[model samples]
Target: MDQLPTVQPHSPIMAVLTEIEYESGMEPSFGSIHDFCLELQELFTSSGWFFYVFSLKGVTKDGITGLYRDGSRWTKSKMPFPDIVYNRIHSRRSESSQIFIDFVEKMNEASIPVFNRRFLNKWEVHQWLNSRKNLQRFLPESCVYSRNSLQRMAASHEVLFLKPVNGSRGRDIMRIQSQDSTCDVSLSSRNGIESLNTCQKEDLPAILKRYLKKQLYLLQQGLPLLKMDNRSVDFRILCNRSSKYDWRVTSTVARLSAQGHFAANLAAGGDTIHPLRVLRHFFGEAQSTSKLDMIRELALEAANCTADSSEELFGELGIDVGVDDNGHPWIIEVNSKPSKNDHIGKSSCRPSAKAILEYAQILLSETNPPEKGGSR
Candidate 1:
């Protein structure tokens, strides 16, 4: 395998793309997001940065490539170190993994700006969001779980989603809904409902046991989402912070979940539509117009809140916002590494991806004080 170019501590700005490999049994097959990652690499490359991607499976031409495997001897080229690193490590793979963690720590101590800084753990992000007042308006009730907390949350919400605390792109999510004395559990997927049935209240013990065996998950109250043709629809609001620290909305689109599915994730056979049209369909013309404006403002505010409170230097966020029947907007999830799906060919939203790339370039060029050092 070809070796990665060695980077100096004070080298010119370059973007490092690295992947965190999953455990042998626990990786999602590559999908649209993988393509988006490539587009980001191209964008970074075009902006005069040496863009490189490292994965456990060895390098490929798809992105500036590097690879790592256990017990494999390797060497890095003598070149200037990357100025910025895009940490795209998968979460399940990261748990109890030393190699990638060590690499990230070394980069941090060297003052290389990581897009989603390694120190900014997922729980910290959630905690930051929970503490903010402006963000509270958009967020659903969310809590990190202990066995007692999870049980209480389940009993209180009657309908909750159990999500891997660090998971992304809609994988390993289980929705638990209560119908009178029975509870229904369903796993999220791209094809269709993976499982659906009624479980007696007494089944909670076993279900919780199975869920807790994983050792990490978050319980969130399910948002009452507006539906299209009997399927839930939610909005993905893309926002990016400019080098100047101003937060801007890059794109907002509605994702209608596949029929019979509860999630509105695009990866799961969900189709995209203009948010305005969906707003109109759910709310009449007069109300829809006003609601769109409201949603846009809320999204920008949510993004800013996350950016300001968190220690990470986030250039972008993919915030999942759901609209209820009454046209109220609620933040369902906040994604630090928002997918660049808007860049897919010949789409009206493609420009958003270009804009994000440009913003990333600006961020790479400018220097901001580290969050711990001082105020921005």
Candidate 2:
């Protein structure tokens, strides 16, 4: 007999949709999905936005058939057109489908705004940022990985990274080091980090051919990243659009790689330390402030650059930046469909989540402004 809480001052309804394969109660809902919806609902309701969670399958042309709080339990209910949609379609396979594309297009035609539009391709983002002269210094030399490109980069930089153009969570990344007679290759796999050593540099093409036969890869010069406890570390800057549509750095977290691993992605057995903690640990308290400011500025620039390039509206980005031993910052990667994990920020506020709803409200107000009575 536990009643579902109701939203307050619910004038504008917001829908959060994700891919759900089966009906609820037929099977257990994904815990993460449920938690995400629950958390978002609480935040949205507190801010006077009516929020509900629905699956893609539940949407229709007339309106959306979604689950809403009905006394003690969630029950099927129909909702009018939503003012905005917060997409949480987590499956790559689902997003790739023609059906999903058509659905989004249809929603667009119906005038519903979707935030954090889609996943960004690494190469496309790099190419966009690389063309800007101001951003060029922060970008490492990167090009489509080909037999010749790999060899050329190997001849230039002592170490290079081969990354999938569409990869996430540091999956399938490889670290390649060109030695006098051999190329040292280390791959990040689900099982663990694996390395291929003592392979003649001349035979790299043949050896890599099988692995990259149909995959797209980017070869980037490896920066001498700052290390923590002898493990390579990088920063993940969570940026979100303000109510005014300006990009703001919500928070920055430092990810330290597992020993012997090059990737600092959380999925790759890495650990996260707050950037302030990292700064204090590396540079004394007296010097951490300036360095922190430098990182914030760099991250803001990257976020704005990405926003300028993307034609679709994106409200959030996770930008990975690395600081070399010399203290120069480099843009490593930019993720549009960023995972919202551990977003606790200054003053105990979940900045990323709060920013999302605030921006969504701004968008909705612009799109569907309330009528002013007895006004000029």
Candidate 3:
């Protein structure tokens, strides 16, 4: 596995690995990504790091073959193997492929850092968190999707959520409410929950089978989430590893569910506001500050637990926590590749971009130190 030593680049390169966009007729596109590459390039220009976009095809090649912006157009060329790989691949299916696995293994053997190497599904994450007792309080009862499991959960909890293991943007999420003799099923679309159907306990399985077919789902105990204006509220806490490789809360915001909706995802037309603002509206100003601190602590704990649960390196994580009527935080979900940067910079360097570059530099130095007169 050893090759002749070659001089490392003076300016470290970071390839933002992304999937290709097929519908981008003439213009080059990466995984529905538009201006991300240009913005990152512009942001890192004044720094010692270099950022370029790499396609999934590059992963199977000999060296890192990537594309970069020349002017207004994109140019394809072979790039110096990245000092660090920041995976931005948006497709869960692509990430699960054998090629992606092999690529990550190769990088690991070479001591090349690839942060957020594998996308973690809901079931896998649940199992990981279940390994630690201290973190169990923040987790809801979750199990792999099955008709019997769904019915069993429904029997115990008055409310349950049937979620696709790999579903995103709140699509195909079903909420079930059990009554005396009828079970109600509510389906969430791209926007939010738009329709509901009620059925008997025996009829519920037939309906779900017709809707879900053979697709996998996870059954979760639902929470009576805090609501404002008849719409539920949840918190998205973005945690990033600092230059020192320590977990820190990058930002936290409260998402208000769309009108007549149950899902609070931004892609589902939900609105985001400062968490402190929402807390103040409920709790006193002084209490709001303390409550925010508590949420941050909980988020940090979840972040650490996630990193410790997996063998893969994680540079950042997006932890979604649902606050019940009692203001208790429960782990709703964790996103490995969270892209919502509501707190992005307007004039200065973008915080998320800066954090990524700083973490990359740390990995490069940690993996292989530089010589006396040069950097690794």
How would you encode candidate 2's per-residue C-alpha lDDT over 1-376 as one tens digit per residue? 2333343333677777775445645732533456556666678767766767777676666556676544444555665556788777776777777767877887787667887767888899998898789889999999999988987899999889889898888888888888787887878786566885548989888877756637789899988989988888898888988855588888888888877677787766778888878777777798787888888888888888888888878888889989887778899999876665645444433667778788887887777543321010
> Could you arrange the candidates by TM-score from highest to lowest?
2, 3, 1
TM-score of each: 0.75, 0.88, 0.87
**Whole-model lDDT, candidate 3?**
0.76
TM-score computed on alpha carbons, candidate 2? 0.88
- TM match of model 3 to true structure: 0.87
lDDT by residue for model 1 (1-376), tens: 3454533223334444545333455532234455554455456545544444455343222323342111222223222345566555545465236755665566577566667543234566667776877667667777776667766877788788877776666777788888788888888766676775567876765765664436577778887779989989888888777555787776788888889777787667778888888988878888887887787787777777778886667777777889987777987777865655543236533555466566655654565433322111
Name the better of 1 and 2 by lDDT: 2
Instruction: Give candidate 1's error at residue 66 in angstroms.
Output: 5.0
**Which whole-number lDDT from 0 to 100 does residue 359 have in model 3?**
78
Q: State residue 20's C-alpha deviation in candidate 2, in Å.
A: 4.5
Cα RMSDs of all predictions? 7.3, 4.0, 4.3
Model 3 weakest 10-residue run by lDDT: 1-10
Give per-residue CA lDDT, model 3, range 88-109, as digits (tens). 8887888888888888877777
Candidate 1 Cα lDDT to native: 0.64
Which has the better TM-score: candidate 1, or candidate 3? 3
